[model samples]
Target: MSPAETALPDLVDSHCHLDFPDLVGELPEVIARARAAGVGRMVTICTRLKNEPAVRAIAEAHAPVFYAAGTHPMSAAEEPLATVGELVALARHPKFVGIGETGLDYHYTAESRAIQQVSLRLHIEAAQETGLPLIIHSRDADQDMEAILAEGMARKPYACVMHCFSSGPRLAEAALEMGFTLSISGIAAFPKSQELRDIFLRTPLDRLVLETDSPYLAPPPHRGKRNEPAYVAHTARALAPLFGLSLPEFAARTTANFDRLFPRAAGAQQAA
Candidate 1:
């Protein structure tokens, strides 16, 4: 095939924080780099309920960007608990594609576990009602996370993705069993992340997605520096081989998985 016909496949950064300080100020250039790297789409997550406007504005302003919002687990105790009604209202926006970056995070704010559980359940309800995927950010709270998610699903089924997943095998299994997808982040590309990578390797391809979680996990070469959507290619580069596919093939699958989970983004991309 001619090189023109063999172009690299486009990928989506399924979860990121474009509203964060490390990225919000330099969006134009950051987005430009992402496009140049074949990362043609992104989902910027809003961790605080108060900042949803700013986050929504980024999605509205950027054609390739969509957004999600919820009160983060770490701040669950500090912020007013997010209401299902509020989140359902937010999802009415054309560019609002997902429900949360919410889940438990006992690693830092274990004291807020009770409120976090309440917030997570509310987000779950919003997702269930609105038919939007829930973007979860879990850390060091695997057992409770599993229980709460399972309980919530039993109460009312909803779609979900374990964003930037680095939890244990049991949690992974639980999420997969619950029909939740797992997003591979730059953390999976770290030198010592073989265990995490192994877990991913065992996951079904259709249940996999990819993200930068940018301004956080930058992958190799750019490790320790502020991450951007462009760096997702590096994480893809590392993960694709393990899946027994070239970068383009893996990109295509993960991008398709992303579109399947976040249909609004797919619709917006199609409309664009």
Candidate 2:
């Protein structure tokens, strides 16, 4: 490894899309780069239930990679609704660590709001039943997202992390109030993300984790290009000072937060 890669603190990419085309064609190199940069683990998310098997295969083939399966909110209208039983069954996999990048995304598909809510609730129920953290992707529907999440908690508590949380403070506060975590992605490392950074600054360090959301939001030095897991270190490096932490200290805290939210992944790491 180069000096730069060697200097990176160990961290986890809590959410990414390794099975997606941009990364899948060069999976081994991508994973090797991640490890070289001290990204010790990653959770590749399956956005459609039909693609779970393929996503699972990626995790099984790579020691540091784990997987989660659910119907993404944006795809809810076109895809078949996921059954809670199905999600619970998938959670039985040793490497399957969380549920549903599922939640409301009314940004582009506002027409499908009703089905999106239905999908989000089903995913929440599965998280409640399986004891796995619910990985949420919310956008442009904060009111309904907050209300539904509250409704789920009212029925029964479940662990969750708001992935790529670039939403309003109200939603952030609501999720934190419900014992959920907020995942910091490369978006937080962008030059114009001061407002987003401010929101994270107010959040407790223990309630935060790190993700790449790759191949999507690559941080500075790689912005506007395809994102990869290794770039998560840049995000940690950028935000560490906000919490009065060194890079290693910030990485350790976020990795711990990830482990707390996704124990199965942590346990698997321990066993390995």
Off by over 4 Å in 2: 1-7, 270-272
Over 86-149, each residue of candidate 2 has an lDDT whose tens digit, in order, gives 9999999999999989999989999999999999999999999999999999999999999999
Each candidate structure's TM-score, on Cα atoms with residue i matched to residue i, is 0.97, 0.96
* Model 1 residue-pair collision total: 0
Q: Which candidate is the best by TM-score?
A: 1
**Candidate 2 at residue 83, lDDT?**
98
Q: List the residue pairs that clash in candidate 1.
A: none
For candidate 2, the TM-score is 0.96
Give lDDT tens digits, candidate 1, residues 56-175: 999989898999998889989989888889999999998999999899999999988889999998999999999999989899999999999999999888999999999999999999
Which candidate gets the maximum lDDT versus the true structure?
2
